[model samples]
Target chain A: MEFLLQLYADQTRWSTLPPDQAHAEMGAYAAYTQALHDAGVFVAGERLAPPSSAASVRVSADGKASVVDGPYPETKEQLGGYYVIDVADHDAAVSWAARCPGASHGTVEVRPIMAVPTAA
Target chain B: MNSRPAAYAVAERAARESYGKLLAYLAARSGNIDAAQDALADAFTSALERWPLDGVPRTPDAWLLVSARHRLFDRHRRDVRAERLHGALAAAARDAQRDFERAGEIGDERLAFMFACTAAAIAPEMRAPLMLQLVLGLDAARIASAFLIAPAAMSQRLVRAKRKIAAAGTPLPRVSPDDLSARIDAVLAAVYAAFSAGWSDPAGVDPRVSGLAVEALWLGRLVADIVPDDPETLGLLALMLHADARRAARRDSTGAYVPLAEQNTRLWNAAQIDEAESLLRRAARARRPGRFQLEAAIQSAYAEYRFGREPAWNAIVALYDGLLRIAGSPVVALNRAVAVGRLRGAPAGLLALDDVAVRSDLRDYQPYWAARADLLAATGARAEAYRAFERAAGLSVDPAVRGYLLGCARRLGTAQPSAPSSASEGKSPG
Candidate 1:
């Protein structure tokens, strides 16, 4: 089963960290990604730009479009990054999620990717 | 057997006896639990329909296996993913044919299937419920009630879990010896959780909650048989059996709660105690101690009372000390404090209880309050004991236990010859 692990952490905390500490944190994430690759379960992963760079978009019933300045439903913790990996089950996804550096100071939410049915 | 009722009884008996074995064999072969379950359900439906008209087969299990195999083939043939499923079904059919020739006995892959249920990929909380459904053939509603989950939510959880198992391709037979210990721990925890769920409903007023204890025992015994040398497995079996043996003595004839210290030893099942003792002895020979072994040893200490001897409280206290070192759970600490009270005195017990009172988890835990009340009463602190008893009674979910606690408080209040203070009469509101 494939699962999408959303890594959420407070964006403000990243800015307050000392330069060396931020570098070390990035190293930890690099090591985690390397481990996932070594396990042959890694499919795709990317660290996102801060929520400040994000825009919220909406389409109304009459097909009118509206754009907002920041991410939708502003919250303390932001979706800092995400990893989509093919693993055995939810438990396996959780195990990987725990290994992510974000889990130490933040949260790693695991959601199974819905399997798309093929046309018969 | 040609009669519909007779055929139904025969089919039901066969299902009860071999559902896990059949499902395990099918799922292990196909590597898809969801499909295997659907095929087996269809097979049972066919059995109910055909057995009366055609007469029950001499080897009902083999008949069912053949029926289920055909269903699997047909179901897959209609699927867009038939080519891939065909290979697995073909292999399963070959095994089914061999087993059919062997007559009544079907292959037992239940241990592997059970291990699959506890795979690292599955969520911890869902493991036991999934085992109950897939391995034991229990309906989701019954399992939901036992676990205190909403029926619809439980059904969705089970469906999603089954989908994951099918999609993830959990290697059933490849559970290597390197990870067996960890896997077995997961399996044992699930079984114990199931047993605890049933044991909590002491009165057995709900039919849904009552049968899980037996099913868990059956699962424990099955695991013990498959992993004969694993001491912890035997220890778990012993622990469960010791508790089960005392089930009859947990309540009095009047349906009042009977604490273990005052329970009638004669009411306990001697046969089950003997089995537990032998299993514990076998576990001890392994020379490796675990949480279950320590717990079983404590229960064994109490079982000595059945022999007309005072319980070996010293050994029990020592066992709890060992348990505290490993588990250190509030409940274990509370129990240990109670044991310390028995071996030492109320003051020592109170000191011990005070040590664990700092844990926030024990604030609403009824047994902690009850233990404190008992020790307070022992030290002649009647007023404090009365309040603690009231707190414990208010926290208790069982009506019998609440009534018992209230009775204790009432006794304490009446023991004083003077009219009770307004504070002591706090149990009643104006």
Candidate 2:
């Protein structure tokens, strides 16, 4: 099954670091991808920009449609970037998710992709 | 080393020894890497299926190699029996079997097989397949699966490659020490290609994919030893070794994603950093002037900065400047933009990014958006930053990375810092 492991961090925390510190920090991200790709375990990965570019929209109590440039939220945490992995089982998926650099501070939601049916 | 584990080890060693032997035979007989791998795989599967019952052949390798090679001929003859006269196929098989029967005799058949597979007559792309098949002696089943092609189709490519070489009179491309410079790049390129094939984890979703990096690095070192003074060759080796240094700490204790800045600095490898430092120094000192030298320097600087020290930023910037003069590719410019971000703060860095050519060649590379989005976010353009993050998220193949970018977008939507009237004045690049 394909599992999408989503991980995120606050952009503000990282965005304004001195360039040296920022470059140092991005090394971990590069290393992370390199580790997986080296092990032949990495399906795919990439780095992202910050959060202010987001737009959130939702239908309110009035039942009206609202559209925002970012994404709608569940409580405080929102949908960040994700990794789609074709692993053998849930245990492996969880193992991979736990390795994400942001796991200590943020949440990683692991969900299986739904099989679409085309029944007549 | 004498127990149940020992017994298991002994058995495993025996299997590998026999397997390698069978591969040697196949490589010799097939006249190319692909066909050799196919025949070797058939031998291996037959062993796996029959070993439990027959208790492993006394000369299991010879038995399997001869059996698998001849069995394939049997099938070919059976399929094309109507044109019995064209059994020149059988003639080659008979001749090969006779030669193989003499046994334990050698004339560098494996090396020649490799040369044929990596023959210049074949396209550049097929060289890795040939090496992975002939040099490493991996089976066709595994190699084919890794490349994500049908076995039959892969077999045809191998056969066609072999036939082309056989017809070309077996003029093996030689790289004597004097003329090694040009050929060394091609050789290194093949090694890089091998790792690239495995990097996507094409065959299975298992951790087995990482083995490709090991293979590539090993091959890189092998070629390096053959021609030691080649700087770019050493640079590729240093770069891979340095990149591979962080294998253990990439994930968290729970295996979730970990960004580099957030990763436990304690876990980064000192040994790898030292190795990279020495190698980068050696390559740079040689003054060979090549892309590998600059890229390795860039990465070496990155590895050093992992410790929170201001690295040789000026030297790295100089290296990128050299790269622009040499390759003039947008990717280099984009990377140079990061250095600009460091040397002259984010605004100047943004200007550098803006100045980079991104019309057709680099419109789709994810790193470009990632860099642009960083610039926008730094300057308080949150919405545009989010859009750039989204593009980066979609363009990359890595799951962890995509998830990370998406997280960045999510975090920005929920959190906002005080807007700086002048982002250029916010933080010094130093």
Candidate 3:
């Protein structure tokens, strides 16, 4: 099964960290991603840019689209990154999620990817 | 000739006994518990419809399996995923037929289904209810009542859990040996949770919650049968059996709560007690003591009272010490203190209780206050004891237990300090 692990954390904290501490944190995440690759379960992963640089788009029912600066309805824990991995089962996905560096101080939500049926 | 009532009885028996085995087999093959359950329900309906007219089948389980397989085939034929499921169902049906001819018993894939129910991906709170439904074939409403959840919400939760299991492709019968012990622990914890939920309602007054304890016992026996060599599995069964053996004596003729120490020994089930003792001995021979074993050993110490002997408080306290080292919680510490009070004087027990009183989790726990009240009254602190009794009664969920605690307080109010005595409390030494 395939799962998406969404890492949620305070996006602003990264800018205020000491250079050495920030480097160490980055190194921890690099090592975690490397471990996932070594385990042969890594599909794709990326650290998302800060929410301040992102935009939210909504299509109104009147066939008009509206765009908003920054994430809509800003929250304390912003979406920081995500990883899509293919594994044997949900338990395996959960184990991987626990090992993610973001899980130590943030939340790693594991969601199984829906399987789409193919027509013959 | 099979009358309608007799047919119904046979069908009910089959549903109760073979539901898990049949569902496990179907779900393992189909990889979708929701679909498998529907297929099994259809099979039962067909049985009810046909059995009365054609008489019961010679092998009811095999008959059900064959019928459910046909239902699965027919249901899949209309689906977009029919081709893949068709292949799997054909293979499953062949295996079922071969196994029936060879062993005359359905394949026992229940362990796999049980582990799947308690998989790490599932929410911790939902594991027990999911196990009750998937492994034991309990309805959502019955399980909802036992867990004190709304029926509709429980049904939704169960449906989502089943969907996740199927979507995640949790491998059946593929649990590695390295992960076996950990997975077994999760499964054991879920079963114990169900048993405790049921055990709390000793009076069994509510029709919805009444049969949960019995269903949990059946689940325990199924687990013990599957993993016979796992000492902790045997230990859990022994623990539940020890408590069950005292079920009848937990209440008096007037339906008042009777504490373990004051319960009438003659009303206890000797047969179940003997079985528990034997299982505990078997667990001891393995020399791998876990939390369940230690807890069972403590219960065994209390069972000595059934034979007209004083409970071995020393042994119980020592077992609690071991338990504290492993699975220390405020509840376990509170229970240990009660045993300490039994071994030493009320003052020593009070000191032990003080150590656990610092924990915030036990602030509203009824048993802790009840234990404190018992020790306070023993030491002749009438006012403090009365307040504690009232607090415990306020926290109690069971009316019988609350009434007993209030009665204790009332007695303390009317009696003289010179006549101070510790009244019995309910279900000590957890």
C-alpha root-mean-square deviation, candidate 2? 13.3
Segments in model 1 whose C-alpha atoms lie over 4 Å from true places: A1-120, B1-14, B42-60, B70-94, B99-104, B198-210, B416-430
Candidate 2 lDDT by residue in tens digits, B37-114? 555566666665566445656765557557765666756667665224324334434555565567543223333344
Shift in Å, residue B86, candidate 2: 13
- Candidate 2's C-alpha runs over 4 A off are A1-120, B1-35, B44-125, B137-171, B197-211, B278-289, B357-360, B417-430
Docking class of 1: incorrect
Better lDDT candidate (1, 3): 3
lDDT of 1 by residue, B171-208 (tens): 46467788777778889988877776623321112112
Error of 1 at B1 (Å): 21
Candidate 3 residue-wise lDDT, B1-430, digit = tens: 6567877766665565676887788688767677667767877767767766676678877888888777767766777576465566556666777888999988888889888888878897799999988876778988876775556778999999888788778447577778777789888888877877633321112112234666777788888988887888988899888877877876799977777777788998899889988999998899989999888888888888787897888888999999999988776787788889888978999999999887645644567777888889889999999877766654454556656666787678898533222232333322
Root-mean-square deviation of every model: 16.5, 13.3, 16.6
Candidates 2 and 3, the one with greater DockQ: 2
Best by lDDT: 3
Better-scoring candidate (lDDT), 2 or 3: 3
CA deviation > 4 Å runs, candidate 3: A1-120, B1-14, B44-58, B73-95, B198-210, B416-430
DockQ top scorer:
2
Clashing residue pairs, backbone N/CA/C < 3 A, model 1? A91-B121, A92-B121
TM-score of chain A of 3: 0.94
